[model samples]
Target: MSRAGCSACVRAQEQLAQILADYDLRLAVVDVDQLAEQGDPLPRAEFGDRLPVIVLNGVEHGYWEVDEKRLRADLDALR
Candidate 1:
């Protein structure tokens, strides 16, 4: 996630939330700028200004947008 209020990020987050509503998912919003300011591992260097990055199991799943179909496929596989 980005602190710059990226529109795409916001939309993706909302879409993901709706998609995973039926499942038990632990979604977190990480402000890259804040993380950088705090010297966290998730800095802009890695994530950059790309808003609404989806990370699963410590690996990036998607960025800028939520691939709903792909996400559903992944979740189905998890089940």
Candidate 2:
């Protein structure tokens, strides 16, 4: 999603990355604009400007920010 113009998006990304780091996981940032341009289903067509969306195991857990408590729980489940 659009992390460039949103401060909350940046913060969410940083927090999610930090949390996942403890589990030795790396966060993957997707270039949504490119996907949207290509007419991807979950991009510009559906999501629009809502960004910094957190997709955990292919399911949306949060948007515009990372749900820290839920994220911690989800990541912990893997361990």
Which numbered prediction scores highest in TM-score against the true structure?
A: 1
lDDT tens digits by residue: candidate 1, 32-60: 88888887855677777666788866778
Cα error, candidate 1, residue 13 (Å): 1.0
Q: Ten consecutive residues with minimal summed lDDT in candidate 2? A: 40-49
**lDDT tens readout by residue for model 2, 10-37:** 8877888898898888888765767766
In model 2, what lDDT does residue 32 have? 72
Count of clashes in candidate 1 = 0
Model 1's lDDT to the true fold?
0.77
List TM-score per model, in order.
0.83, 0.79
